[model samples]
Target: MSAESLERQTRSYLSNNVPQIQEHGGFFEIQDVDDESGEVTVAIGGACSGCGIAPMTMNAIKHRLPDDLDDVSKVNVTRAGGPRAAVMPTKTEEMEEMEEYKDYSPPF
Candidate 1:
């Protein structure tokens, strides 16, 4: 299969099978495709850069791509940005939680 075809197949598979990536504001980029060896390198970018679930996403791509696509023999996924510091809860989030129990009555 041609490189172009392999890329298209990969994109289609990711979009359909891995909806979480797109839903979480992340996307996969086709870095390299070797038609001879059937190896495809993909990069996860956007919100997935420092995402906690990035590892799981990479694993899914690595294992599922080959099984799903006939032309793809191997998949290598990499994240764009490395690890990031944890984000603190925003005021809005805190307020939303407070509002949920604002009307609660104590049983005591």
Candidate 2:
């Protein structure tokens, strides 16, 4: 198959066959399609960007992509940002907890 066809097929299959991805708001933009190596480089964005379970999503896509079609040797999912945002406790509760643990420290 031609690289252009493979790229289009990749997008179509992901949008259709992967219902879980669709439901989870998985947004994938095709960065580039390599015909020589049959590799699809996708940028993972939106909810999947900040999600903790994004690795699972990428894995699912990786394993499933080949199953859905041929010529796709690999799926490369990468994050543009540094990392997912950390979940922090409320300010007041966090302050109280900090005060409680203020004196507690690991002795080197």
Candidate 3:
């Protein structure tokens, strides 16, 4: 298959099979496709940053993409953001206080 067709097929498969990715504000980008080697590189981004389930998603992609698509021998899936992106920002004191109040139950 041509690189363009392969990319298109990859996108379609991900969208149909992995609808949760989009529901969670995540997306997959096809970075490159080697026609000769039948290898494809994909970058996962958006809310996938720092997401605990991303590793599982990556593994799924690596194993499933090749099986689903013709001429795809190997799949390389990587997070778009680096290590720093995995660290969620700390909440401020005000935000913590708000949560404390929000969770409080008043007695009648």
Best by TM-score: 3
> Cα deviation of 65 in candidate 2 (Å)?
1.0
Instruction: Report the C-alpha lDDT of model 1 over 31-107, residue by residue, as the tens digit.
Output: 89998999999988777655655555676678778987889999988755434323323542343246544444322
Q: Give the Å shift of residue 66 in candidate 2.
A: 2.1
Q: How far does residue 74 in candidate 2 sit from its true spot (Å)?
A: 1.7
Q: What is the lDDT of candidate 2?
A: 0.63
TM-score of each: 0.71, 0.64, 0.72
Q: 1-108 in candidate 3: lDDT tens per residue?
A: 778887888888888888777788777778888888899998877776656556567767787789877789999987666542344334322332354444432221
**Cα lDDT, all candidates:** 0.71, 0.63, 0.70
Q: Residue 39 CA error for candidate 3 (Å)?
A: 0.5
Angstrom error at residue 51, model 3: 0.9
